[model samples]
Target: MKILAIESSCDETAAAVVEDGRTVLSNIVASQVEEHKLYGGVVPEIASRRHAEAIVGVVDEAVKAADCTLDDIDAIAVTYAPGLIGALLVGVNFAKGLSLATGKPLIPTHHLRSHIAANYISHKELKPPFLCLVVSGGHSHIVEVLSYTDMRVIGRTRDDAAGEAFDKAARAMGIPYPGGVELDKIAENGDDAAFPMPHPHVDGAEYDFSFSGLKTAVINLIHNKQQKGEEIPVADICASYRKAVVGCLTDNFLKAAEDLGYTTLVTAGGVSANSLLRRELERLCKGKYTLYMPEKSLCGDNGAMVGSQSYYEYLDGNIAESDLNAVATLPIDQRGF
Candidate 1:
């Protein structure tokens, strides 16, 4: 089946054409990083307008690049929930219009599920019944994948997500907007043990996570240094902070997988692209777990993963009518239309 997918979640407007859910014929994304960077973070209004302006052309490019026309698309898939409402509405409405015009099936997908399906694009051999850690700017979760269309969240953040913590910590250090990547680069030169950040302990939820305290600790350290006219070691702070955050996430995920007797461990979302996390997975999961991570390109929001997931949603009869609208706070497991 050829699925044409649209993704306008957050600041990225993306489109992709996938065949049988595993092969990507074409994938296109127009980033709003430069525009959002000016504000130190995403402005919802700006993101919505940008999605409106980019969706049409992005879809056209995807079709052309995939060597197909609208007539060749078997299904139209879109991320309908768990994103900026306006941004999501643009894609959802555009997709609805296409479905109306072409008489094709419209499939609704969840943003988190799309992230998990990114693995299908890279690791074709990967299947269900694995433990996955999904970490992004807005979410941090450890899920047990029971099947392509079935999953159970085993652990999640009780506070800020790891990516959010990184960005806030970077801002505290006076780093630029979208500072996580920059912080990671600078952290490569610092000592991880220079400042040992404390790990959070959830009372009874051993697999749960908490990064708010860690984020505050970094901010406090930076603020106190400036108040005392002390030099702030940016690299060391980034390194130590990254280590602490990565350690918490890694530990929880590994513990969950071990407790559940899962040998295959998968990671999805933007934070999965962290160099430290990737390195640590290599060192720790070596002889114990088989690790899977999506290609860096798929780590961020994109349509290919949505397309990949739509195939399963399609099999499960998860189709939507023209009246289908966008949802900003839809839960991931609510697969029903």
Candidate 2:
């Protein structure tokens, strides 16, 4: 089945056509990273305006690149939840209009679920009943995929998500917006042990995560340095911060997988593109479980992953009506309508 998908969850306006969930005919993403950089982060109003301006062109390009038109697609799928409401509405409403005009099925997909399904597009052998660690700009979750359409979030961040921590920490260090990638690069040349960053180890909730304390600690360290007029090693701070986050994330995920006896481990979302996490996971997880990560491009927000999950949603009778609306704070396991 050919599914045309749209995703404007945040700063990116994307579209794609996916065949049978595994193959991507075409994926087009127009990012507003450069625009948002000046503000040091995403501005909701700007994001919404950009989505409105870019969504139509993005979809047209996706269709052209896929070598097909609206008639050839069996369904119009879109991410309708867990994002900026206005940003998401542009994609959701555009997709609804397409479904109406072409008389195709409308499939609604969750943003987090789409991230998890990114693994499906990357690894054809990957299937259900696996453990997925989803670390993104707005969310951090550990989910148990019981089936393609059935997933339960086993753990999530109680405070700021991992990606949020990265961005905030980067801002504190005078880095640019979307600091995660820049911080990672600077970290490559510095000493991970230069600064001591706290790792919040929440007891009892073995699968849950907390990064707010870590973020605060970094802020405090920066403030202390400024007070003393001490020359702060920016690279070292970046390296140490990255190490703390990666270490905590890797440890918790590994512990969860081991405790649940899951043989397949899938990592997804924007933060999954981190080099340190990828290397550490590969180095530590030898024979214990198979690790899967999406290609760097697919790791961030995209429509192909949404289309991939939309196929399963269709198979599971998860279609939505034209009245479907954008949800800014939807849950991972939410079902019905």
Candidate 3:
């Protein structure tokens, strides 16, 4: 089945055409990164306005690039939940109208679920019944992908997510707007053990994560150095911080795989693009487990992932009506429509 997907869940307005579930024929994204850079982070109002303005052109380009028209698309899929409401509404309403006008089926897709499906696009041999570490700016979760349509959250964050923590730490050190990516680049030149970071533990939940304390620790370290009139070791500190965070995430993720007897491990979302996480996972999984990660370009929000997941959603009867609305927040396991 050919699926045309729309994604405006955050600062990106994207569209794509995917065949079946894994092959992406065309993927187009209009990013608001430069606009948001001035603010050091995403501003919801600006993001929404940008999405509204770009959705039409972006979708049109996607269709054309795929060498297909609306008649060739079997279904129209859109991200409808767990994002800035106004931003999401642009894509959802546009998709809804497109479905109505074209008389195509509308498939509502969950944002995080799309991240997991990104793996399918990158690794055609990948299938369900494995463990996935879904870490991003808004969420940190370890999911048991039971099937294409059925997933269960095995572990999650109690506070800030891994990417969120990365951004917060970078900002405290005067990093640019897309702090996580910038931080990762600079961290490469420094030692990972220059500064020690607290390794937090969730008392009762073995697989669950807690990053709020660690984020605070990094911020506090910077503040203390500034107050003492000492030079802040930006590269070294970031390296240490990245090491700590990666350690925490990998420890629990690998533990779950070991305890649950899962030999196949996958990672998705923005944080999975982190060099430290990717390298460490590769080293750890070398002999014991199989590992899969989305191509770096597919790590962020995009329509291809949504289109990929929508194929499975359509087969599972997760279609939506014209009245479908965007939601600011929805659980990963729930249907967006």
Q: TM-score for each prediction?
A: 0.99, 0.98, 0.99
**Candidate 2 accuracy as TM-score:** 0.98
Q: Model 1, 1: alpha-carbon shift in Å?
A: 0.6
Provide the lowest-lDDT 10-residue window in model 1.
328-337
Tens-place lDDT digits, model 3, residues 44-66: 99999999889999999999999
Better of 1 and 2 by lDDT: 1
Off by over 4 Å in 1: none
Candidate closer to the true structure by lDDT (higher is better), 2 or 3: 3
lDDT of 2 by residue, 174-223 (tens): 98888988998899999999999888888889888999999999989998
Query: For all candidates, what are the clash counts?
Result: 0, 0, 0
Q: Show model 3 residue runs off by greater than 4 Å.
A: none
- Residue 315 of model 1 has an lDDT of 90
The full ranking of all candidates by lDDT, starting with the best, is 3, 1, 2
| lDDT score, candidate 3 | 0.95
